[model samples]
Target chain A: MAQRIDVKDLDIYYGDFLAVEGVTMTIEPRSVTAFIGPSGCGKSTFLRTLNRMHEVIPGTRVEGSVEMEGVDLYGPGVDPVAVRRQIGMVFQRPNPFPTMSIEENVLAGVKLVNKRISKSDAADLVESSLRGSNLWEEVKDRLDKPGAGLSGGQQQRLCIARAIAIKPQVLLMDEPCSALDPISTLAIEDLIAELKQDYTIVIVTHNMQQAARVSDRTAFFNIAGTGKPGKLIEMDDTSTMFSSPTEKATEDYISGRFG
Target chain B: MSTTAPPTGKARSRSASGRAGDRGMNRIFRLVSTWSGALILATLAAVAIFLVLEAWPAISLGGEELGEQISWFPEDTSIITFVGPLIFGTLLAAFLALILATPLAVGVALFISHYAPRRLAQALGYLVDLLAAIPSVVYGLWGILAFAPIVYPVWNGIAETLGWFPLFEGPAADPPRVMATVAVVLAVMILPIITAVCREVFLQTPKLHEEAALALGATRWELVKTAVLPFARSGIISGAMLGLGRALGETMAVLMILSPGFLYSFAIFQAGQQQTIAANIAAQQPEAPPLGVSALIATGLALFVITMAVNMAARAVVARRKDFSGAN
Candidate 1:
């Protein structure tokens, strides 16, 4: 069974300025959860805190607990490296290691972390990971080509394959389809539905329709003004939230009345 | 209505004049910019041509005596003791300096870019900049009065402990300035320049690439080793070549630190047996006979060729780097 993520009373700060304040949410296991909001609304910050990736930035800190499968990710003894290994992340842009080949990029996590896998096992892993991401047929013949040579959509799928190669329990995608064309966006959305069967996935997107189409549950966040912390406006099942959100602010944002 | 029509025509004429004035100013700016660029290139070309012309006589004279048995002297008691110990010493010292300075420069660059706090890194950077501004004569004076004396005991200790090895054997009497000491001083003097250039290159690494490495569960050291080092490898090589050029042309510091002789010997510990070209030029150019002066110029020509080759190699590395970085 896969593990669920529970973020409790989370507050993120950049130096002395609070970016997100007192937000709490439970992300169900084996389901697709979406965070949608305007720019600078702290959706990305909340997502980064789930895997302790927020601490990588200088002067950035997070308060409160993000627990995964009963283990507190921010505990004193917890290694953020280990936490990130279990909870993989994809960024807004597709950043495959330019120096590595397509095949090498897919197997980077396994090769970098575990040194004992045999050549045959590694090959099998690369094939299965690429197939799972629906990129095997497109890139199978050119595995030795550099990852940077691929098109924008192909590179994003390559990053997806790289993330899944380690078989992480949770995958975080920050606007994975934002940089893709319409056709690529549909392909990624379809991949998300299939991926939910094996791993918990959380995505942050500014595209409200993407949230409505792909997520099992949606959380809408908004900021009051400049220098104010972002706050969660609503969280519910996908259909109810899109059709009839409980909060007036969520309805106003969804209807394009105001951001 | 007739009066208004004349006033409107006057306004149109005024706007036309303003547009013409702006166009004329733009043309003047463009011409000045183009001339400035051409002037800079012309100055560089002139300097290169002048050096070659001044050094031509020695080059031709040395070529004529290439097959001589002893290279005893040219015409009119002008000793043509060319292609001997000193040129070899200069190359060896520069090579040693490169070996010692490269790793330290890269390490300091990595520290400043990835590890140090902003204020502290800025302070350290200023300190390095100050090193480049310090006068070469002051460095020579410091080497003679302070560095040599302080480092003498350490050198002597190594010699005493490892005397059985050929490289560590002490000289017969007083320990004089040798190749090893000169190489060490050169390394110290070139360290700041190399580190500065390398730091700038390392800082230019894309932030997204670094974040991607971290998000893949790589430790900080692993991230640097896998991503940062590989990405900046060519830039670091270029920076090292730049440092080597400086070390090769350095004169006053090497002259003050080395007890240069005209004999060629491979032994590291022997004093007054090794000398570099730059130091030799400074020491002998004043009292040298005409051919001796030409021989020194010939040596200068050799140094010039070496520096040009290094710069060309550095340019090649820099040109290929963009392809490696996937920027093309």
Candidate 2:
């Protein structure tokens, strides 16, 4: 089941340096929200903060509250491991534990909880999750094969399968399609459209057309200069953000003027 | 040299030139490279030929001159001994060192690569490198004068508490200078070589793979278990082998730590009683007859075979684990 996120006055920092400042927004449940910005504007950094993964890096911390279903993720006693389990993430590159097989990768997240599911149930879980990712028919026979042997798009979908296997409340995708070919990118885009009906999905993309095509709502991020922290310039319905963005920066960025 | 020149061939060659000068240097490097490659096989062949020529007396001098016993004093006795015990001693001591060093080296490597803070890790790394630089004779002196005395109580305690075991069942003498001491000292000596290689390998675990593990809700240690360690297995084995190589061929350190014993005693706790091939050759080579020298060389040939076998086995381990290791 999907859950809504309420982030209030979030400031992301790597050591003493402010990366993204005062990013306050609510991401609705069962919808696709795209965070778009140029390089160094901290879109990916902000995305990582949502899942409490930003703090994994040494000396990196966040101020302000990221709430998932009324519970603050950064609040005291909230384990980052638990936060990650509840909210799954797919990285830019389709890194399917290079040591694992295709089936093992699908089982990776669930196995992290240290629960012992029955063999039949695990096989079923693998089948259903692979089916959900639209990869079961193609890979059902060779589940024992190494995951890295798959093509780029297939690997991305395998990653999606791996993430969704956890059945997280929210799925945070950070430029998941950038390294993929156009056809694979389209497959992921279509998969995202279907996935949003069940799970709250947030994606970070530099591709404006991708933001327009895949997201229900688009949040544009910007920075003043190199040393400045990135800020959310605007958030609007996908159509409106592309057609008539209120902020000059958002419009210019959308119009290919400047980052 | 900086020169602004738009020039003909003569001016181009004679100018203060990086590009033109590099061409002659490249040819020189090519010639040097050819010789370097050739020298490797040439050196191996030369060593093998020399060893064969020197050991011919022991190999051919049948009936009591050789092929009788493993004793070094060949001139005094009519029956000289084969090098079976010396071969056994060298391998056992090296193996003993390996088993002792592996866990400690891996722990130190893990601490440096994963656990320690950046500054502390750097400092520890430098200290370990310094540990590796201490001369063998210095280690021998320190082991006998300082280290052995310090370690006596602990060794005696282990011998008493677990003395029922064959390895510890022997006499636990004061300032124990047995094969076990040689092994323990070799472990300390090889620690840096193993740790340094493993630390580098652990650091080479891909950031993407590490992040992948973390994103899967793995704790720091679990991340290491799933990602860092599986990735580092080959390097660790190879590092262990490097340490093992040094332990096998070690002369001065083992020579000082172990006391002389000609018998095949299985007990490790007995002090002042062991002779590895290297220590035997180092100690007795000066006073030995031609047959004695040839016998030593033959023993050296056996050690050469043992080291080769150990290396081959290490290569096999690295190759065998490739599927699960993710190094391919």
Candidate 3:
């Protein structure tokens, strides 16, 4: 089951400094929304806050509200751990739990919540997840080999399988293809196209062409100067954002004028 | 060691002499480093060879007499070359100390690395270091006079309550200078080394791996179980072996706290019954007859062999971990 997200006037901070300010947006259910920005513009920071992962850093905090289907994730007594299970994240660099095998990496999130699993159910989950990420054909024979033994592109796909296994309502990608080659990047873009049919997907990217190619809607974020908080410049239909005039900054960023 | 490329284009002539000077210095440094390592290995080999040479007479005895000497041990006191009791005593005391120290060391290591606040963790770590810095002689004197008085009664109480168990069935003495006393002292002495090493390893678990666990909906304890523990397993084994090495070869603390007799008992609670090989050497070497000295050297050689074997075993365990590894 997919979930819609409504973020209202959200301010993110690392310790005393405000990192990103007054972000208000709605991410529709079962749709692909891409966030594109210059480096250090708080695009990745904003994605982490979606899953309550921002607070994992010491002294980092968030203000205002991030609601998933009208339930405030940061409300008192709402556990960050529970918030994370509802929204899974794939990091920029693929992380496949170096200690685990490919099958184990796929089942890691499910196993984290349930200590004991029926063998048949575990096998089914692993197969379906790997198939969903289009990695099962490549890795089905050597399922017990260490996840670290895979190439960078395959490792990223394995991480996707791991993320999908948990059955999270919203899937967050923080520049998932930035570390990948063109072929791997294309593979992920195709996977995103299929994934949005069942899950609400929000991806952050530095590549404008990728945002245009994969996203239904695009949100542009920008930083004014060093030490200044990043702000959301504009949100529009991907076709409209690319072809029509909006803000001067968004036009500059997308049209290769300047960051 | 220097394989520097020649300067190209305009700068080639200007840099030529400087590159030659650098290469000359690198060659000299490499030779010096190689000689330094060779000298250390040569010194260690000399010690082992000379020990065997000096003890040759006692070791070369005919079959029956050598066999008798090995069995009667230091207790015989005539012809005085046996060592079975000393070796067994050393093993029992060190083994007991290892069992006592390992769990406590790991707990302290985990607490400092993961659970404690930054300031508190530093203070606790410093306190453990202080435990190591206390001279062994001070540890010995404290054990004999202050520590023994406190633990003697506790040993007696354990003997009374759990006396049916052979290990607790102590013939508890007035001063209670037993193998158990030596073990507790050794555990205290080795605790700091094990704790320090394990703490460093736990701290080295990659931040990426830790965050991966957190994002998988794992609680803090689950994160430690999944990531930290697997990563630190090899380090933990090596740390424990370091402590075990110290316990095996310790001299002064065992000399002062344990009563020296040739008697052997696997029973840890028995008082006034044993002495380790290192303690026997320190106490007997000065005034020992020539034959006694030879016997001591032979025992010393045995201790060296045992320690080397343990180090080899540790290396094997640590090496296997790379292939069977759960962590990068």
- Residue pairs with colliding backbones in model 1 are none
Give lDDT tens digits, candidate 2, residues A1-259. Answer: 9999999999999999999999999999999999998899999999999887887689999999999999999889999988998898999988887778899989988887756988998999999898888899989999988787788789889988988998999999999998888999998999999999999999999899999999999999999999999999899899999999999999999999996
Model 2 clash tally? 5
| Candidate 3 residue lDDT tens string, B46-105 | 989998998887777644554454543333243233567778888888888899999999
Give the per-residue lDDT of model 2 (tens digit) for B115-135: 999999999999988998888
Q: What is the TM-score of chain B alone in each candidate?
A: 0.79, 0.85, 0.86
Candidate 3 TM-score to native: 0.91
**Runs with alpha carbons beyond 4 Å of true place in candidate 3:** B1-18, B62-81, B161-166, B171-174, B324-328
Off by over 4 Å in 2: A115-117, B1-31, B67-81, B263-265, B271-274, B323-328
Q: What is the CAPRI rating of model 2's predicted complex?
A: acceptable
lDDT of each: 0.83, 0.86, 0.85
Flag the better candidate by lDDT, 1 or 3.
Answer: 3
Decreasing lDDT order of the candidates: 2, 3, 1
